[model samples]
Target: MDAIRIQTSAITRPSINLHTNPSGISFMKDKLLETDKSVFSVFGPNLGHYADDIIIVFKCEISPHPDANFSIQAATSFVSGNAFVLRPWLGKDPGSLDE
Candidate 1:
């Protein structure tokens, strides 16, 4: 019982006080959505249909996450992986400036 209480307290305290604070919640939500859009832009219009499902799922899963760092990291990885996979067909590398 004592161990369980200690574990629970440890888990809840940081999350409640640090991660899930009300004010930062809104900012995290916006940042996640903005990230989704920014990554979508990199893929461009031709891949819209293909990437739409990815964006929807990413938003639904990560938008409510309380840890801002984890959420953004997940978003970045997801977008980067998808972008890398689709780059060949998109006809341009992600780093290139050419139109």
Candidate 2:
């Protein structure tokens, strides 16, 4: 598995406005319809307390076979010398686990 990092000063910013409609369900439905074949979710530190940055971990399928294998990948951020670094990883699938 490979790990990547993404850093930004706006970590606390809101990416999506779930209150677009009187009922929050509408926004979610619209988002789901816009989604592509691959689905992903975002995770971060717990409420009240926040981390210095954010990290997103996911896997990419590299084969078209029904039993296609997946490669582990991550997107996160880190603090450098007075600056933040953004790193991403897209590696080749490691093949089936039964191998």
Candidate 3:
């Protein structure tokens, strides 16, 4: 939709990389900053795990998204709440249950 097109157009396309190291995430990110001649930072590691399930959050501005229903740029809590249903599950310890 228009939202994706606008966001993708404004967002920089990550450059081609040959390194297969898991840190290639960092390399692609570094290239983005390098191309812009600025320092890039990693806020923290492993939102869930080091798998591709990891997500990167860049605090950038977006024009009011028609689907976002927000007058301002989306915030983490706001976006997460709208996008996912968060719940906590209590699981028995495997060892205890086996005993």
TM-score of every prediction relative to native: 0.28, 0.16, 0.15
- What are the lDDT figures for the candidates, one per model? 0.44, 0.31, 0.35
Poorly placed runs, candidate 2 (over 4 Å):
1-33, 36-38, 46-99
Candidate 1: Cα lDDT at 63: 51
Off by over 4 Å in 1: 17-82, 85-87, 94-99
TM-score of 2: 0.16
Ten contiguous residues minimizing lDDT sum, candidate 2: 74-83
**Alpha carbon deviation, residue 31, candidate 2 (Å):** 5.3
Weakest 10 consecutive residues of candidate 1 by summed lDDT: 36-45
Scored against the true structure, residue 60 in model 3 reaches a CA lDDT of 47
Please provide, for model 1 over 5-78, each residue's C-alpha lDDT reduced to its tens digit, 9 standing for 90 to 100. 99999888866864454332233443654542333323223432423233223466665677523321334433
lDDT of 3 by residue, 1-99 (tens): 999987776553322232233233443433432322332233455353422443445434532554322322112222234212332232222232122
